[model samples]
Target chain A: MLRRVRYELAGRVAFPLLNALSSWQRQLKRRGRKPRANPFGPPLDCVRKLRELMTAHYYVGRYAQGAVPVAWVTSGFPIEPLRALGFHIVYPENHSALCSAQHAAIDLLQAAEQEGFSGDLCSYARIDLGSALTGITPVGRLPRPDLLACCTNICRTVSYWYKNLASHFDVPVVMVDTPFVYGEAEPHHLSYIEEQLGELIEVAERIAGRRIDPERLERTMRAAWEGLVLWGECLQAGKAVPAPWTAIDGFFHMAPIVTLRGSEQCNSYYRMLRDELSDRVTRGIGGIKEERHRLLWDNLPIWHKLRKLSTLFAERGFNFVVATYTNAWAEAADLIDPAKPLESSAKAYTYVILNRDLEHRLASLKQLAQEYRADGAVLHSNRSCKPYSIGQVDLRSRLAQDLELRVLLLEADHSDPRLYTDEQIDNRIQAFLESFS
Target chain B: MSTATAIGVDVGSTTFKAVICDGTGRILDHLIEPTRPQMEQQAREGIALLVERLGCDPALPISATGYGRKRIPSARQLTEITCHALGAFHLTGRPGLLVDMGGQDTKVVRFGSRGEVLDFAMNDKCAAGTGRFLEVILHRLCVPLTSVAELASKAERPVTVSSTCTVFAESEVVSLVAQGEPVEGIVFGLHRALASRVAALVAPLAVKEPLLMSGGVALNQAMVRALEHALGNRIAVLPRPQLVGALGAALAVRNSQ
Candidate 1:
């Protein structure tokens, strides 16, 4: 009972006050800088609010233990059910991504490597394990998980990554194994995932020490579904000739949907972003000063080099108007039916680009290219993401032949900067752009 | 008489080359030297020496290309890939494929009929299909760079050295040496390995006919023969192939003027 009191105090009073103070201080710092013109239109006004929302979330997490059930889950895991159970969810993958963006991942990666983890392992997994072992994180503190949930819809690595977390924390692990979908998912595959989701609820119910509520889950699913719909609308704004925003902006803006889905704030945030982007489109504003070439990006971003990479292309009047990675978040929104949450989630998660066959991926790439009116494509042959990078050679050739698009296969890792060669990539990009001349 | 009009300097990994070209794209003067560690110093001194030797005006626009193109304070900087394509297109006067195997990189470039680069592929951060691989292996095997082609030609049957990694291939070559394999056969085998690697990069492209070759490695007679055998096509070596990148740079600066 006392723990509940303390939790309310932290969530409602202390964290909100602290977050407000931090936001005010940041605004003061921002005011000192010269108000230079931004080619990508003015910066998003709600960004500081976003920082406040995320900071309060993490800050409140410190007091979540003993007050509510804590479940550490994958980014793609079915989290709506957990929300219905009143669990305080923590996404390690998202946190590791934050670490990667801040360039704090290499030290943590080295820490994991020293403890027998291979350097070739997924960087997110390494950063998380390294944080777990060292009790170090950019987030104030990660509440100890009462449950670990993992879904294989993203990749096979998450299952093992979560299992290790479960073993270390000595907690129960709930696995939602979505079979890889080739074309359309087999009915059996959906049933299998539905059954696993049912088991997941039981596990989450036990952890929460309460009964599962179907009506609450329905409400959560409705919000999640609406949130995704808004996100898809936001991304569709990129079809504007100059594009209302760049893909780098999209990469950062995706945080709310990834971390705060199934919440009112998450839905409202997307609505705001969508409206802003739509207004930009109507005003003839573009993401870059000049948009000479519209290219489509394939695979994950180089988190460590976003600034340098974005500037290089921006200066060349090249802007990546859309990306397959960011679109993955929105492409499956139509498949999510709130009426039958479990069955639809099973289907939607299974059909993600990573889980589908190369043919489906190629078709999706073609559709996106046509829809976005991309003149060329840059396919990153990422070293860390084999699931995403496999069969790209064939895809590159097909895109060129079928779409008559120029394609460049860039070899680099998304998270690890050590794998990138700046000089080589510079030469390749210059040559590619020169071809257009 | 054609006077020294424009200048180009190519600061490559293994060698530095400079060319002085007249307004008509005709070469009037040229210089070559082993590249020094301090690229800025070498590029400055090399450009001065070339201009002095050619009795050229110092006010001419100078363009630079290669790995250290930016190191040289020049009027224009272009990548070796573009420069090589430009030089090859001028040399052949026709649209075709170009294969330039340098010290550290191997490129397969396809240019349009008017000397514009259409498509290209380069070996990824590896020295297997490059001049450095042969240099290291030959130096280890007690064979001089000039003798590699002569000795490799004498071997009736070549031994196979299959590793694509430079370090591993060196070890494999050493193991073959320990087994009493003939040096000439081993050298020829190394050439074949490199040829096959370069061929794979070209296999995926719809290569234009009348394939052209350039760069320092193209001077190797055995490697050229191995490449022709692997490609199953006649290879035309550009005139003074080592000067191609420098010549391209000179042409670019002059055209810009």
Candidate 2:
């Protein structure tokens, strides 16, 4: 009970002031920034709010242990049940990315490697496992998880990665294995996932020592539905000529949906973001000062090189208007229905594009290019993500043949900076953009 | 006829190509030498040789291209892909497929009629399918680079060189020789193996007809023939192919001016 009081004070009183202070400090330092050669337009006003929301989440998370049962979950896990069961959730992928962005991940990655994890394993998994083993993270601290949720809808690596975490923390791991979908998911497949989710709720309830109210789960699903729709709207604003934001912006802005989903906080944040983006669209405000060629990005971003890559294209009047990675979170909204939350969520999480066939991935690319009116596409052949990068060579040809758009298959790892070749990637980017001129 | 106006240099990984070109982008005089560790000095010396031979002013504006492009003192720099596209467009006078097989990398470039790059793919990951691959394997096989064409032509049936890796193929070729396979067949097989890797990069591009070849590897008639067979498209080797990047560097500087 005392732990709950500390957690509440951090979330309600302490974190808000600290977040605002940090945001104010950023604004103060903004004046001292070299102000030269900035290619971006007016920065998003909601960024301050985003910082507050996310920092507060992490700040409050520090006190969550002994107060609330915490479950470390995958990005694609069906988390509504956990939220309804009053579990403090943490997405290790998000934490690893934060660690990457902070430039603190290399040591953790090395720690995992030194512990005998192969270098070729997904960097995200390696970093997370390294953090688990070493208790190192950029975020203040990850509350020790009492439960781990593994969903194979994203990748098989997560199941094993989370298994390592379970062993390290001595916790129960709830598995929701989504069978790989070919063309379309069968009823049996959906039923199978739903049965597993039923088992998940039972395990979670036993751990929480309480029964989950169905109404609360439905409410959480409804909020998630709203948040996903708002995110879709925020992304659709890119349809505007001179998109209101860039895909890099989307990559940063996606934190809420990935972490704070199944909550009113997520919904409220998106509502404010959606309105701001819509206003930008109406006012003809672009993410960059001068938007020329609209391009689409596929696969995860190179987290360490985000600023360099963002400026590399932006200064050249090229903006990434859409990305398949950013679209992943928003695309499953249609599969969600609050009335039958469990079944709909089962269908929703089962049919993610990564879990589907390559044909669906291609079709989605084609549709997104047309909708976003992309003149070029850069498919990041991520070294760590085999599933995303496996069929990109064929997709490059198909996209070029069908759309006559210039496509560049870039080679880089999403999280591990060690694998990136700076000169080679820069040369390709310069040549790719030069072709537009 | 146009006189020498601007000099361009391509400081490639294995070779340095310098050319004095006229206002119309025609080569007046050129120089080619193996690249040394002192790239900028080599570039300067190569330019001096071209200027002295052409009897042009020593102060001609220089534009640089290739891997060591930025290392040279020059008015402008461009990547080999763009330079190859521009030079190929000048030679062919039309946009199509261009395969530039240099010492360290192989590039498949598609360009527009105006000499602007449309698309390009490069294999710089290793020595496979590059001029260096041939150089290494040929030296290992004790075959002169000059006799590659003749040796490959004499083989009625090329032996299968399955390894695309340069180091692995080196050992593989030695084992084949130990097993009494003909050296000529092994050489031809090596060319075929390199051509297949280049072909894989080209296959996804689906470039149209009127394919063109350029760069140092274009001097090897055997490699060109193998690429032609692998691509199943007739290739027109550009005139003074080794000087194509230097020529493009000249044209690009002129365009910028």
Candidate 3:
């Protein structure tokens, strides 16, 4: 009872009010601020709401330990069922990315390294395990999980990461392994996932001490599907001559779809974002003030250096309109059918970009490039992500050969900055941009 | 042909090269030296020396390339990749895959028929496939680069140096010498390993014929032969190979003007 009141008073009430107050203060300050020579366009109006929404989500998480049932899940995990069961979902991957962007990850990464975790291990797993070991996070607190859900649709690393989490927090872990799709998923491949979903629901019910409600699950599924469509519209807005938002901005805005997919609030956020973006497109406003060359980005973003990279490209008049990473979220979810939640969930989540073949990935890249009229592409050959970075060399050559686009394969880790030297990487970027000039 | 009126400076990681060129991109006067620690001052002095040698005006338009290009005060700055492409095109007058093995990095650049950089691939953040790889390993074997061609030519059976990493390969070279391995064969094996590593980078390029080689490493006949044997193509070494990047930088400013 005390936990419930604490969650209500703090998570639901206090954080929302405080976040709204700060958002208004920031807006007022912006209004009174002097205009300066900036390369970016006017800040998104929906950005204020995005801050308020994510702030409340993380702030309220501090009091969520005893107040709600928590399930820590991977980004590719099917989370609608957990949402229906009144479980507060904690996406450690999202939190790790948040820490990286906030410049607080290196401390946590070092803490994990001190505990003998290999420097080669994925940064997300290291941060998750590091925070668990040292209890240090930029987000005030992370709730202890009652259940841990991992899906192999993204990579095999998550299963091991979650297993380590289960041992640390002493919780039940449920894993969903999706077979890598070659051309198309066979019936057995999907049935195997459906069977796993059944087992997950059974385990989830045992933990919640309640039978699963069918209608509630469908409602959550419907909400998730709607949120994905809205998010896709926001991404397609980049097809405008002067794209409404850059793909770097899409990386941050994608947090809600990844974390809060099944919630009405998540859907509403995308709705506002979609409207605001199309509004910008109509007014001929670009993410950058000068959008001379449009480029396509492949693989995950370098989270720590987002600002430096975005500003560098903007100053060079190169704006990224489409990214395979951002497009990963916006695509494939259209396969969802909320009426048959479990069956469709099995199929929709099975065909993720990482889980699919290289040919599929290439087709997607080519299509996005053509649709957006990208003059060139930059593929970040990430050190930490093997699954995403493996075929990029071949893909780079093929993209250049087929599309005749000036493609650059940059070697840098998405999380760790130590793997690459600045002068070498920057020199390549300058030359790549120069080729276009 | 245009008169010699422009200067090009290549402030490389290991060695620096400066050249005075005509508007038609022909080298007239040049300077080459090991890079000093004071890079900016060293670059300015080298440019001054080349100008003095040719009795050119100090106000000659200068274009710079290489890793240290940005640090140098030039009218224009470009990366070694672009400069090397333009430079190779000037000498060979044909486009193909050009492998430029410099001190710190190696690039496999495919030039279009018209001399544009069609695509290029650089060795990753490692010194394994670079000229520095052979430099470090040969230093461990007490072998000068000048003697590499002579030594490897005499080796009846070239010994194998398997490690692709420069530091690891150095240790392996030490252990091999201690194990009484032939020095000529060891030198033969070292260049072979560097050749294979660069070959892997070029395999994916799929460029047309007329393969070419440039940079300071091209001066080593053994390394060039090893690369030809590894790639299975007759690689033509450009004229005054090491001056290609400097030549390209000089041409850029002259052409733009």
Candidate 4:
């Protein structure tokens, strides 16, 4: 009888109710009743204030010296150092994302599709190409890039992206080489990076037509270190009974850390966020109103699957307490050391992208799960993200045997919808939840 | 009794499925369950349970499909597209177009006369048009999943689903509800929105007939109706929609052996 009701409800009441709820939430946002912080931790207002202060300061710094043409480059070589040396930083990822959010991505993506770029090429790439061709940002927000520095550590796409950007902008391009670390960074690799860093400094000095201010560079590095520590602390606070924030919130709040790493404002903002998270921990509030099972997520979410998966889990009384990728940003922030700013900054920057090694990724995930007291781990075997997809089976086996934690391998993609099936996925999730019981 | 028996398993994002078939593509028994912590273990257990239910021998050779196929420790791991094609061919007895909508993603596969995958288009990144997207919308609406089709049928005018992102889409749905839009119209609109998105993906492929719909989303009548309207043609849905991938895998295993 319950099954019959559920079956009926799926088609009739559920669909309409969902549409109504979605519309209502939008209205609430427009009315200035911002989403409350998950009662698990920290007030939303506090986090917002901190974020505003940090971003404002960072922007002021960027605009302070005649508007340094800085591009907030994605995960790669220490572009912050270059920005400090008086160059504009451009982040293609951010621009591409803006296009996506604005619904301009489809058109732009289709344009790129005509240029022989496979439909499988990173959506970000397609969006970027589209934006470049269209010469129009969704909301007229993205800044034109002046210089392109492609770092090879993340993937080959960075090089290709820079090549295109350099040609389009007719600017000088720099390529930073970091040998892939199979397991751990070696002294030789560190020395190689140091040499590249010195060269980068030389290039910046030439471009700015100014001498390097060692003290100012040191100061920036110090601020970056402080910011990282606070960020790490904020992430750790999620280990509290009700995590202070969700992964989605963390993603939204990561802008400062990524864009303004070497600024005092970033540190202050994180400090405020940390305090609120700490307060939440003290209050013992979980993100979910009623938490039943706490689970850890591995890899990026299958974007198309997130809603269905989130609902299914919620219905079954399962709450995702932590995710390794989300916490990784915090870990990267923690690596900054004010005392040894340059070395720490270099190391911290290197840790941003996750194309390094299986062991490194596994260790980070294991630590997060343990800290969060996760009952189970759901690994999304994403097809498009090869860097993330590899070594999952080994990781799953190890996590289960070593940590005695339950692990489920979910096959899906971060963006592609054709890769997964609903009924099969729900059944697997339901079974996994039942096993937990 | 059939001289040959084969097993097909689909390790989906959220579930593990097994289908045992006779030599002629007749299903003997099938099992579906939420994927457990260990996919390999869950798959093995699921297959065992199904075989036991059907009183079949435990030594049957198994072929796996879906995203988690490689992780199943099965003898053969085939792609979901391959499985969908085979399943469609078996169910419809002809090769045409295959549309499989799963939790997180959707696919439109073009099959040749021989049921080979000629070309396919997939949407996996965003949840906008997939089953997962519907589930989220359903939860926010406090409506049961089963009622979506009926509610949609009552919709006089289609409401627009403004946001493509599931998170934002939910907010959009909520505001619509607040505006006092009829639940039925909104439901119909959501299905239309999803169908439109799916249609965009299917538009690239050379859509042939008989258009066979597989995967979990095929059960959603509203979605099916919307898709049919979008394509301006009728689609054939299998009796057990979710088992298509597993059936495809079973057929592949039998052919290979």
Candidate 5:
């Protein structure tokens, strides 16, 4: 039928054209391919042009109307209720990182850094400021934020970040506070967060000037929870011999789950991704051609060293089967109770990122290693990120004693390339691997 | 008469270097190799090879330094800053400033009298100033490592590498090459550009000399020269440049014992 004809067209014509375009682009950038530009024509014009194209698609299309009232909520805020309320959401973390990769984040980041914010402050903050100043974001990217919200459960950075945004836009600001849950959220803590959730609903209703639909919110929460569960299931599928997908690919697809949490589209995407992964699992597909040793990666990657490290691991048959960050998302999903929506939403929001205790982080990593049947663990002692980098040495010792796991502490920065050395890192990895044999 | 020989390993990001030294801080043997998958084994093997080559005893006390030292179980670990200062001070016979540029990271160490570390600044998270970044660009250009200095010597104009990230800088270098800029010119620009980055680390410390440059990157004459030019002064390079970390570790072991 028509579907078959369309598929034929896509396979025969569209795919080839796309492939050719990609190859041509690659060729253009190859060494010795083109003449170098003058020292100062338009610094980062390519980045600007790309951002313009992306922004046009994101903000100017018919989908713009369909764009649900979206807000950028910081971690530690009760975004579940907003998701439940059917509002579109976006995480600035993902967007800032995209901006960083595009090289546009430097000017903006420098502005903040020069303002006496140490270079060690999160790059995301600098990138966000950069995007606001430059107006360059990916094509068809984030919808404009209609509200700015903050919570204190995660880190103090968000309050300042949101305050800056609110001042920029002259928009209303909503702040939520959730008492820290030492281990798990108690009933009182839940009640406190629940009260804030109620206030959020009131504030949101006032801003939108619309009647709040409780049933719709409940439905959204249920769907969002389902989507999160499915996403976790997809990650679990990577536990197979070859690891059906790499962490980089997982990060790419994590968008819909983070931004469109309550929607049918989010649910459908996860279901589809889950099914595709399941198929890969059945077919026994692996990420690496050679399966040597499986290792657990602790903390965030040294962004500057990801490729080198991945290549190093791949060449040696050491696949990073599991990570603590990826697993944290799913754990939050399990805690979301759609029936008692607001309280659960608050609880979920309060617990994310590296806000959890050191022991919790260690336990999660150990669980992933055990579940993935990993041979060893590589802990990147990230220099720029103190919050994520702390307690790794202790965790390494504990894992060695309890799990009897071999551990490697690799010092590097997640984004800053200045902190790592290939000769040093490579030598250490070689030594660690030979010990396993 | 016992030699009292000891082994010191400097496990860097891009290279695994080891040195064997007698009790008087005289280097007997040394080895430098690309860090492989089995780093500790590589260190052990490299040390063993150095010992065998030097006709030294196999059963020497060992100490480790640099980023990967904690993972190497054979020796007590010392920080790169401390070790670099010790090595520089030992080589120069004066305590002043030390600049160590390894594969992936850069550091500027300030030493007080008697080689005590006063304070230090490091550019460890960024790649713009490190030796690994130079290697990546050189590999992309299909140029031998030794030719980089020669290439820089021919540059008519310096091309600025604006990226703080090494990956992005590689693309920038590739684009420069594609633009048909002379390879030598580009190489010169790269060294100058990287020197500027290292200068940023050094400038903050306002370090006084006898300034010493150590680590693998110190072997790059062009970079060393460019760095000297950037700082508007002369810099000293250790005779056994790569052994600086290992030397410091050995010094630490000797002092501790």
Candidate 6:
């Protein structure tokens, strides 16, 4: 009982105080530093708030192992029920992305490869496995998970990846098997997922040693839906000619929705972001000062190379106004209903862009191009994501024929910078941009 | 005869090419040589050589292209894809599909109505079907690139060389030679393999006629004929095909100035 009290006090008082102090130090440093000249418009002002939210999240997480039920979940896992049950959720994919952005995952990835994980496996899986093996992470520390939640909505590989984690941590893993959606979810598919989600709630409650409050689940669902709506609005602001934000900013700013979607804080963060973006749109502020050509990006971002890639495009007066990957979060928000939480979440999670067919993807890309007024598309034939990368060759040809949009199929990886070659991609990108010129 | 207005230099993987173009976009003087390791120094000397030969000032606007283009100090640096498209369009006076097979990569570039690049595809991270593949395999087989066309023409029936990798194809050639397979047949087989790979990149695009060819590989008559057979389209080789990228680079400099 005393241990529980200490954990609560640390989470509520010490963690918050430390987080605030660290944030203040960061702000002071930022204020003293001269702002680097960006050929692009001003950087997002809400980035400080984003940093505070994420820092507080990790800071609280440091004490969460004893204070709350901790669960490691996939990005597409139905997390509302877990959130309602007082579980501190951890997204391994988000962590992997953080490692990639910091350029710290290469050694971890190599460690996993040395342990016989093939280089062809998803870098996220490899990084997570490496972290599990070494307990090395940039977030200071990760809370030991009391439960493991695996969902097949994003990729089949995650199911196996989480299973490996389950064995390492010796935790009860609740697997939610979402069937791949071809066109639409059949009635049976929706019910099947709904039933699994019910079972998931029971497993989560049993692990937490408490029954979940229905009102809390509903509240969590509403917050998640609200966050989604705000995120959609933020992305729609890109439709403004001379878009307010580049897709690179979208990549970084998406962290809250992915990690803290069920929380009211996430909704508030997006609302702030939306207002900022709307103000920029009204002011005629472009992501880049000279936005000559707008392009759409497909597949996962080269996380480690985002800065270099963004600067390269900005230098050429090209800005990616929209990305199919970033739009995925907003695309399924319409299907989510807080009143019918279970059924809606089942539908929303199952019908994610990754679970859908190539035909759906092609249609999505076409609609994005037309709506965003994109003159071209850069399809990263990501080495790590087979589902996203496959059929891109055919899609490239079809886009040219149907829409007359110039397309460039760049061969690179999402997280693993080792798979990317500087000179080769530079040539391809410059040539593609030259076509626009 | 028009005098030089600007110079373009292409420092490719295998060879270096330079072109001095007049204001009318006519090639007044050009030079081609095997690319040496000291790319910057070699490019400097090559550009100086062109200036001396053309009796033009060294201060003339210069553009550079190809893999080693970054090493060459110039007024502008353009990728070979853009240069290839510009050169092909300038040569043919029409926007059409262009197949440029250089030392490191093969590109199938489609041109818009106004001669701008519409789209393009290249050999994916592989040296297969590129000039380097042919260079390596032919070197192993003791066959000169210049004599390959004549040798392949003598074949009654072409043999099949299925391996697309340069290393594996070298061994395949050696094994075929040891098996008493005719050299002429093997030569034609190699050309057919490369032609088929290039054809795959072109198959997706709409090919308007007077389909064009550029780059050093266009000089191989057998390869060109095999590519025509594979693509089922007549390829019109541009004059001074090897200098097309350099010509485009020079023209770009002239246009910019």
Candidate with best DockQ? 6
Estimate, for each residue in B1-257, the C-alpha lDDT of model 4 and write its tens digit.
Answer: 65439999998876678889998999888888877778888887888787777787889999998778768774587778778888888788776888899886787777666666655556645677688898898899887988888888878999988788999989999999999998788888888888988988777554456777989889988889999999887988887999999998999888787
Instruction: Give each model a TM-score.
Output: 0.95, 0.93, 0.97, 0.56, 0.58, 0.95
Summarize candidate 3's per-residue lDDT along A23-137 as a digit string, tens digits.
7887798896788776888989888778778878888888888888889999999998999998889999999888888888888888889998899898888888899998898
lDDT of 5 by residue, A1-437 (tens): 45445434543565456556765786678859665432111122123232333332233321322335556786445666676554545567656655544545566677667765677766677667556655556533455577888787656777787888788767777888766556876788778877877888887777665757878888878987897898899889878877776554555456566555677766776777787777777877766656677788776655545556777677767777777656656778877888878867777876765767787787788888899888788887876557778888678767876887878778776654544577656655654664454
How would you encode candidate 6's per-residue C-alpha lDDT over A1-437 as one tens digit per residue?
A: 66567667766788778878887887788996888876788888998888878877876777788778999999888899999998989998989988999999898899899989999999999999998899999998899999999899878888788888999999999999988888887999999999999999999989999998989999999999888889999999999999999988999889999999889889989999999999999999999989999999999899999999999999878999999999988898999999999989999999899899888989999999999999999999998888789899889988888998989899988888898888888999999988877
- Candidates sorted on lDDT, descending: 2, 6, 3, 1, 5, 4
lDDT (0 to 1) per candidate: 0.87, 0.90, 0.89, 0.71, 0.71, 0.89
Give the clashing pairs for model 3. Answer: B4-B22
Q: Lowest-lDDT window of 10 residues in candidate 4 chain B?
A: B117-126
Error of 1 at A66 (Å): 3.0
Badly placed stretches (over 4 Å) of model 2 are A20-34, B52-62, B72-74, B137-144, B147-189, B232-234, B255-257
What is each candidate's DockQ, to 2 decimals?
Answer: 0.57, 0.55, 0.69, 0.02, 0.03, 0.75
Give lDDT tens digits, candidate 1, residues A155-251: 8989888898888899999889989987788999899999999999988888899998889998999999898888899999999998988888888
- The candidate with the higher DockQ, 5 or 6, is 6
Runs off by more than 4 Å, candidate 5 = A1-68, A75-77, A84-86, A140-143, A351-353, A383-385, A416-431, B1-257
Best by TM-score: 3
Q: A154-190 in candidate 4: lDDT tens per residue?
A: 6677777667767776767777777777766787776
lDDT (Cα, tens digit) per residue for candidate 3, span B64-104: 99988878865588888888988998887888789999999
- Candidate 2 clashing pairs, residues 3+ apart or interchain: none
After superposition on all CA atoms, what RMSD does each candidate show versus the true structure?
2.2, 2.7, 1.8, 20.1, 15.9, 2.3
- lDDT of model 6 at position B169: 93
Tens digit of lDDT per residue, candidate 6, span B133-184?
9999889889998899999999999989999888899999999999999999
Q: In model 4, what lDDT does residue A320 have?
A: 80
Ranked by lDDT, the better of candidates 1 and 4 is 1
